[model samples]
Target: MPILGLKAPGPSTPAHFSLEPLIRPNILALQPYRCARDDYSAGVLLDANENAIGPALPSASAKKVKVNGHSDSNGTSGASASAEDIALETLSLLPPGTDLNRYPSPTHDELKRRIAHLRGVPDENWVFLGVGSDEVIDMLFRVLCVPGKDRVLTTPPTYGMYKVTANVNDVGVLEVPLIAEGGKFQLDEDAMDEAFTANPDLKIVFICSPGNPTGTVIPLPAIRRVLENPKFKGVVLVDEAYIDFAPSNSSAAQLINEYANVCVTQTLSKSFGLAAIRLGYLLAPPPLIQILTNTKAPYNISVPTASIAASAVSDAGMAVMAEAVSTLNANRDYLLETLPTIPSIGDILGGNDANFVLVQVLDGPKGKVCNNRAVQVYKTMAETRGVVVRYRGGEIGCEGCLRITVGTRTECEEVIKQLKDLLA
Candidate 1:
């Protein structure tokens, strides 16, 4: 069957994919709540029912402006800054005239522009900001899948939150397990094609690159096959939360210009080391972005969050992130080499593209992979040894696997030492 909302494929251009048929009818017609900020956030603003007296918080002192661990020298030190004080400082540092009194921009275009530039997308129109990647995931489900009627496809042993969010939105999940032979957790293309033929109404396919627990990258060729699949008609949601830790040119963001159906979600939580900020975004065509903006809460991106995020995506912030990622990649290399040398450790799984390693724990040096031993090691380390790692022994083909994040050199050595002792 011809795909919904897709134009006939041309010689040079990809089949133009429209979101009209996929988005809920009501959402397409939605006249978003026009918050006060949508009009004017300027002088004499007695709007949005905000506290006209200004932010109800403690006043700021000489506080340091910290963006992803690098603190600005404001000459203040020796005391922990209170949350309110930090919030005030965040407002104080904005380009000059902005304040915390008004609602945040219904559309934070500047931040979106920075992110678009960072991700190599065309412009701000292609970007959609969310509370976090979680919100982005939820929003996709909300717009595309009809609750209690429609379904989305997920590749197993991937990010668990995809399923959780699907369930929350009352959407059914159709899971296709990744090909796990030889510890290569890649997409089973034939199986996925079969799934598409079987479930033609599937609205989204969730692909996690540098996937959680697995630390593997689903190569672009595999993704291109899915995108080029003529039988399937819905959006392909690529979750690249760990992309920065992966090799260069590993992002699906590059496909945005070519395919209208592609949507890539990323976050500050991963490589930027800004989890507390809870900032995440989606890169897609402007039509879909407009629909989401209409559906989302006005001022979803707050002043403090936007301020911090702006600093984070700046040139200086990029430098800091690059240095940090370099250290983590080196640490991951250390784990990949050292973990296998341990007697009880079995095959190192996946591509090890992310900042983690998936190593199997065994019954003995020569014994087979054992989930019981893996569980024991995971628990004992977390409880007794003060070393913690995820026991993913039950996931798909990941028998006896433990997912260990690549920490500092010292941390990597400590976990290796503890695992060696416990498995001994």
Candidate 2:
């Protein structure tokens, strides 16, 4: 029951927030599982029951690629081999360390270092990698909230995962809907404050900036108000899964040093285009980081995932990611300017900070939004037609709304064309 026992913040960070009360007691007392790699990774590397003679598959990383013109061991000319033959040969070979016999590194310091520099954190200590941000989200609930007794705050029409995860964990979720009338989709600070006051026992507050359905950002000042609220002693989770698409300075990672109670979850799934790799991380004060680290599985991140993520956040990868974000932002802008031209298009909500847009589909005559028609159009687009857009008819202020991802210029144009043809 001892709270406020953890160290506040690193010397320079303005955040002097304590973590004892915020973190679950059992978690704070937990002794982390020590994986084999924790002690050493270099030298003989024979500690973890690894194969001595190498993996079962032919080592592709060490082998030279025999040219297509060359003959195979079967004496068939490589040049004469069909495309399927080439694919089979490649499959027969395997990349070095791709074998499943060995365990992955438990502590991915290098990957953390890469993320630290990219996120402008003090060092790797500020970061913790998850299988995906989903894992991190779950870890937060497990580590911070009591199963049936605790609660967390979430903005409605936001990411569904927060509510889903809360429900799975049997935690109560307080709904504070965002301001939806304007395109802002910003946090209703007063309402949230009232909720916080009403629910002081809440353990976490999930805010998806550049929100999922909304595709709009919650401003820093609004976030700061929550973080600075002395009455709300729990963690303020800023899910910046779309931060890269927003303006550079709009990230809450900058506030980590300033607010110890704040935790930011970021992922390579979106802007980095590495969703398949499933690498997401959290940046927070060391105390909370240690809590999650202790609670997480020893080798939650696989070696292949780490390798792919390392390459993705590398200098070259960052350049390519920036370019992709640039293109997507342009496409998003194009959708914003073009979606309204269609007679069926009503309000294109949100600040358009993320890679997607939320468009309201209006019916004829009085221009009223019709959820039934929106659902029909969504089904038609996805099932019958080749095009696909999400129907967010059930969410708050999203009735008759379609969540459209900003695709390539041609693809966007095709969507517009199809909507025009279909709506006509």
Candidate 3:
């Protein structure tokens, strides 16, 4: 199979880097399922078995409001409504022309175009959308790795999904631990090179930048080493799910044009506050993007999702997201400054580049990091104390650590207050 077999339009891809050879044979020859929307989305009398009489919901104007403890068709009140009325109110949020009966566009190019522009990609061809980053992860595995044969290398204490998805696909995972010394949590380049040499058959290398639990960004130079490695020919997956909170110029999306084997995954779940919409996208060279696009479900993204994502990546949406990220970053800073002041809190680990802080929970004011204490505090906060945070005391280099997401000022203060009382 040749990379040229797929007519992907973009800048000149690396001549030495061919995607087909690394892809599963069956996938290379797959005939993508063509949907009706792919052909025409215009005036349709009878196409794709769509209901001509519109969707099964009342008109948006039919929504009612309760006023003075009486049912009114207009105006607002504090009273709750029946299930039907609630459904109507939710449906009203959709555009007046949303056709739920019809299938969504297989290639929502406009949405992709906006996302491409936001991510600094060449064009929509360089992007692929999935239900979430989880789907993007699964699709990469589906297209590249052969079940029970090929393997992927992941950094420990990283996003669990990379390993989980690998396991779900019957693929083996190779662990190369990140450098935990000095709370750096960075990629150990030499160890990764050794793994590549030891496992030449590995199909993908998953690196979670602004890493989960660690919240540290793997600098671009470190990533370049892996990409330029002579021992590995597989794709280098950079999961930037938390990239929004990291410092500027910290993304691997910039490397796609330079390296054909690099793929970057991002989601609207975090910064955009659109997790319910379940939109995630991947940025890569056209060849790999095209293959993953062809392998995904024809209508994996719904019309509502596309609409929501379009608004999210729009200029106004970007402004709103930027403001939110700024606030969260400030909150994260507050945690970094305040967590260490608590009596039993030890050194806060990682770079704190993400929206969370990973801090060690000590047994007493001067005691060592204690897993039992961390677990007790975590359980107490969630179950009895009405506050919640993750206990990552079991992860590599994160013993007796609690991964706390940066929250609003009040929430951040409350957590600090709770920790002080509990540790006291």
Candidate 4:
């Protein structure tokens, strides 16, 4: 059965020796609801038995009166920059209850339109809103993978959700380890090719640019090579969750129109400072987007989440945040330069484009080991220094490494000072 150019295994089709079974027996047997496209049309008054009158709750800040004051130069102003104040100031011009009561356009059309404008993609090719990019990851698995039959290929020491989501869906995971020579991590294209060749049933390939934990962006040629392979014609999910931090152009968003099999997932959690709001999006072919939207539950996005995300994507705020990205990059560079000077630290993995730096601990003079010892040190740093950094030893290829998120100059200095004392 072919849907969206790719072939799904037909009822009588025999499983090829190279190709594992396409769908899990349960998923294959299950029937999905097929609602008419017109069911979601704009002019609907009564369709799916929704309350035509809408919710009874008033606007969030409607009761509170606005207090006038000068806008603070710094982003954080105590009582003066409260949620009410921020909402009143930023959205003051818009009419009351414009976005407050009505269930946010279920598919996030306006938000997607703005994102398309920003990313330079045709709105038709994008799937705009998700709870987070993590939802996109899970949705791809749910829509494409045949749980227990279809598998996903991922490079180790990459994003954890690729495996976690696979496991949740009971899908097989084929691990292709990254090259870890000299403590610098690089994608092993040959290993990836071998994995795809060995498991022709692999439905998804998750590539994280400026990867989490390591922060090394996969080289462009490596990605191109994977896409070029005939055996790897399945969806290539290039998770650009941290791409804004990197200097390299995003492969998924940039090349979406050119490749039908590619999907790029991004989150406002990192750069947009809206992690708490949980707005993530996927840019993919419209056919794939249709499948995802069909599978997803109604009212996936809350009223508050939509409002905050829309506000964050405002032009003025995005420009200000671009400078914040530069600041974080500067802090990352500072840590990269200053960290190796500490006697206890060994090689640093990634400080390339992302905000975090991964540092390996060196052995002591007595030949003491320090890889898996990161958790203890992580706890010490948190307890004594009042600082927190991710310890990544338990992750696939991250033995003996701590992932530290770069903050303001003062914050970075405080962390460095604490590390220096610990090393001493």
Clashes of each: 0, 0, 0, 2
Best by lDDT: 3
Model 4 TM: 0.82
Off by over 4 Å in 1: 1-16, 59-98
**Could you estimate the TM-score for every candidate?**
0.90, 0.88, 0.92, 0.82
TM-score order, best first, reads: 3, 1, 2, 4
**Residue-by-residue lDDT tens digits, candidate 3, 1-424:** 6543356654443444567789899888776567776666677547788787766665433532321233445422235666565555445445655667787888899999999898998888899999999999999999999998999999998888888899899999999999998788988888988898788888899999989989999999989888878788888999999999999999999998788888999999998988878999999988888788778889999987888789889999999999999999998889989988999999999988888999999989989999999999999999988999999999999999999999999999999999999999
Off by over 4 Å in 4: 1-64, 67-95, 248-250, 365-369
RMSD of each: 4.3, 5.0, 3.6, 5.6
The positional error of residue 381 in candidate 1, measured at the CA in angstroms, is: 0.7
Off by over 4 Å in 3: 3-5, 9-16, 58-92
Taking the tens digit of each residue's C-alpha lDDT, what string does model 4 give over 189-229?
Answer: 88888887788767888888878877888777777667667
Question: Judged by lDDT against the true structure, how good is candidate 4?
Answer: 0.70
Cα lDDT tens digits for candidate 2, 162-200: 989999999999999998886667888889889977887
Native-vs-model 3 lDDT?
0.86
What's the residue-level lDDT of 71 in candidate 2? 32
Cα lDDT, all candidates? 0.83, 0.82, 0.86, 0.70
Question: Where's the lowest-lDDT run of ten residues in candidate 3?
Answer: 63-72
